[model samples]
Target: MNKNLRQTDQPLRQILTKPEVSSRMTKWAVELAEHDIGYRSRTAIKAQALADFLVEGASLAMTGQDSPPSGERSGEPWILFVDGASSKEGSGAGLLLISPTGEELTYALRFDFPASNTEAGLADSPPDGYNRGQSQERSQLVVLQVRGEYEAKEDVMKKYLAKVREVIALFDIFEIERVSISQNKRADALSKLASSSFAHLSKEVLVEVVKQKSIDQVQVLAIDSSATWMTSLMNFLNSGVLPGDKTEAYRLQFRAAKYAYAGGTLYRRSYLSPWLKCMTPEEGDYVLREVHEGLCAAHVGSRVLAKKCLLLGYYWPSVFQDAAALVQKCRACQVHAPLCHQPARKMVPIHSPWPFAQWGIDLLDPFPRAPGRYEYLEVAIDYFTKWMEAEPLATISGRQFRISSGET
Candidate 1:
């Protein structure tokens, strides 16, 4: 259809088709290079019947679709196909909405930032546009986490899932199923088009470039600073105030003996050591991250890591457990750690094939300076035969031992 639309008049074609033409015509000819076509004059109609046939055939050949229906339209639900693509060129997604009348509308969407493949048709409300033409009782959503079927791993997508859930809650009936690539060609083509570096297209395809995640609008959260774990202890230490409950006050008094406030920081008294600065879980997490993988840190084991923090004058109740959890979650530690090998069953012993089949050599020193100026004795033993031979040497050297029991 694009070729048919770009088909030009005789004079214009002559200019564009010429071997030597203007720069503009040369560019047009290059764009139309794949289309090797020439115009032919339409013959004069012989009769009314023949003329009607030619006109109708020409119209059908030009547009390849019948004129819109005059009355009621098709009532089939418009099926939608979606696919995602990611490459070095860019990350993108595409949607292909097929009308009940077999008309296809393809969308090419480009993402501005790097992330796992997202629903190309998701951010765009493709269903809302077809409200006038399709069923309205319920909407089916098929997520084409396609290509890799990527899970929503990124925080942006995780947050986006909440919004998607809220919208999906309104649907009465919905169904989703994995579809083969053959059935999703249109959307896949559009996805590739958006993700590739092809700057020129035969037909003008307007790509919707999403500059940022739609769900990333800033949100303000109110956090209570005075309600933390140490808040009560700090209040009691700063001022002589206690909670209204006698049991709670008694417990606070018992725990407070071990905690000392100094330099505007809470410290816990350590046995045979200086006071350890007590840390909240949040601060403890930062301490753990830095100390575990920080400069000069060798990614030590959990027990050692916790001990290091304790030795550094920091205290947290879950320090040991947190260190263990951090080590488990550490990507480098998991990927590059040494492998463990354990025997599947009890050990077994084996006997040698024959006497002197294998030989062992050993060195012994100092025999009061032998005739060859050798101080060490090199001994050979046969595993099966218990045969032994010895030679004296003074200096260590790298050479094959000549066994007295077997072929050298």
Candidate 2:
């Protein structure tokens, strides 16, 4: 018999392996020897099979059979899940962007200003989703109007719709779909977290504060292709061309004298220092961000930061303005700025109707250790009479306190 069959032959197995057997058992053992059977302890086949099955299932779960292959193509679609959350404290949203390669990008947005009907849509639009996403009926998502099923009657919505269309036009392929909130829990949690506080947020999540409405802003054109403030100065140095207007041409001439152009770079003349490199407002803004938020930055005040940049030998017409704007937009500077210690309510002045009518009372201090060992001092001052009285006590008692104040 095979080794597999020998183990299951229980009737023969019982006595086959035993050395000291009775005649009857030995007879049976000898009879079983013809089949080449042997005996060993039985294993729990059912239980072991079950355990192995469970281990295989767990491994399959970890490997994620439903997940798409990592071999990515250039045109693979990106999946973005967004949810908007707002509270009386503030408005914010959460966004989860999943790349085709399975990389997840998480973001929490805090709206700096209070959200209005139109603004609320923008507030939530940062993270809101639909199909598997949104508040469905009452949702103000920008894509909601673009879906064409819903109409945006408000001017702001129209403007937003136009802006959304403009942005979508930039992409070669773009699609919007709805998703239920349950399917987008990560985005929903992020939105709520942003509405509360960012201090307790997870390290993997990025937090951003939106200070202005997107509709109010214009698109930024390329500086090189468009007219810049440096255009006039550049014209005078390169080709000696001036504006037709005498007044403007004269001003341009004066400004051009202070600047020198060579090797395709602009430089400004300085009395005690070497020629300082001149930059456009856009370039200056970048430098300001580096100096104020870079490794060496202490996040100093805007004015101080601008002065430091000047000392570093660079100049721009809107240098100060750019520095101030950058500082104002800095998340760290705004969050950690000096707090006002003043009371929230306005202070009211106490008025006295007449002298000695009523007195203002206060504890002058913890009772001084005087010769009498007074440990508490209760002072009373007449608001109108300007008279004062004080009582010192080594130990305080309700009865003593009333008597000392002449309340009895």
Candidate 3:
């Protein structure tokens, strides 16, 4: 019995030592051995079997899966999952491609603009071909699975969808399916990760994303010879010659003395102040909006708005006027302004010829009951002298008025 068992163990050891099987199974066995010492050998055997199954699947994809005849059915399908997310910070798209052999490749993109889901989908289409390269030509079937409705409703979305369809038309076979968000969690997570503040990607990964330029900066940098104001300033500064009237020429000369151009930017200089950034009309508007109503702005009044722009070292000919106009048009200020309490009309005084010539009398009623059952009082005053007389009464009537007036 012992000899028979040894013979069987020898055959098993020889089978495990075979080069073709050992090369593939060695790494799997070594990894499984780290955690489960008691069952390491068994686990290694199981892992090796699983790896063989995967290899078989891949081999089948390469050999048996041939493209169908022209105008007939297509080859095995490649699976694609897509998702998009938008946040206050930015927008992002995620795509996962599963090859015929079940190998998965993930891709993520971050957008500077607040992109809609449809836009993200449109943005994702071109990258698929770029990543697949020549393989896309051989791929006969391509199925795209998204987490929401595939229909394009908005005009912008329709344009994006049309582009996506154009991209899809390049492939011989294409299909689109709408799946639940939960089913597409991996792609969804990738999108959220791209949109998140903490997703710090390497420069190589972010090379394709375009950085956003500030409206003020873009308008300022867009200044060229075609811009009349900028051209006049540039010519005046460069040659000391003015193009218009003498008064305008003198004004330009004076301004040219105060202003200078460096690296394509116009700057104003003064002995007492720091260099002020001179801006065009559009740039001025952007500065006013950012200064008066940006994230840290307090919605200051017109004069203060202009002062704020000046303090921030920005200058334009119509800075004050533009600030005033922007403040006047501000809906927040209009909706939240405080009520006014000042009198609208002027007051005139009444004069009396004598002390008692013009007397004003009034009756006070419903006072707390005092001594002698008095509940009402009649008061009289002389307008000129500002003198007063008062008498209390238990009852108020015509007879009481006559007694109070000393007419009885």
lDDT of 3 by residue, 30-102 (tens): 5543442221222235888889999999998977668553223434566778777778878877767776556
How much is the lDDT of residue 170 in candidate 2? 56
Per-residue C-alpha lDDT of model 1 across residues 1-408, encoded as one tens digit per residue: 343434333566677678386766887888877875556555555798898999999988877555545222554456667777778888777777667677777667788877555443455433443333221111123253311255666666557666655554454433344567777776777777888864653365668778877677577899875566777888889886789999999999888888988777888887899888888888998999899888877888899999999999899789999999999999888898888687888788647799877778887766788777777778887888889877666576664243322333
Weakest 10 consecutive residues, lDDT, candidate 1? Answer: 133-142
Looking at model 3, residue 136 earns an lDDT score of 23
Off by over 4 Å in 3: 1-228, 343-408
Which digits, one per residue and each the tens of the lDDT, describe model 2 over residues 1-408?
A: 465343452555545567365456777666666675445656657988899999999999987966655533255666777667768878787777776667888878878877643445444442322122212212435456767777878887777677666655655556776677577788778878887776687777888888887777777887657877878898899999999999999999988878999988888888888888888787888889889988898999989988888889898878888888888899999999998899999999888787888887776567449887888887788988889888887777777677778951
Residue 158 displacement (Å), model 2: 2.0
Q: Give the TM-score of candidate 2.
A: 0.37
**Most accurate candidate by lDDT:** 2
Once fitted onto the true fold, the runs of candidate 2 whose alpha carbons sit more than 4 angstroms away are 1-75, 116-144, 219-408
Please identify which of the two predictions, 1 or 2, would achieve the higher lDDT against the true structure: 2
Instruction: Give candidates' CA RMSD values in order.
Output: 27.4, 25.6, 23.9
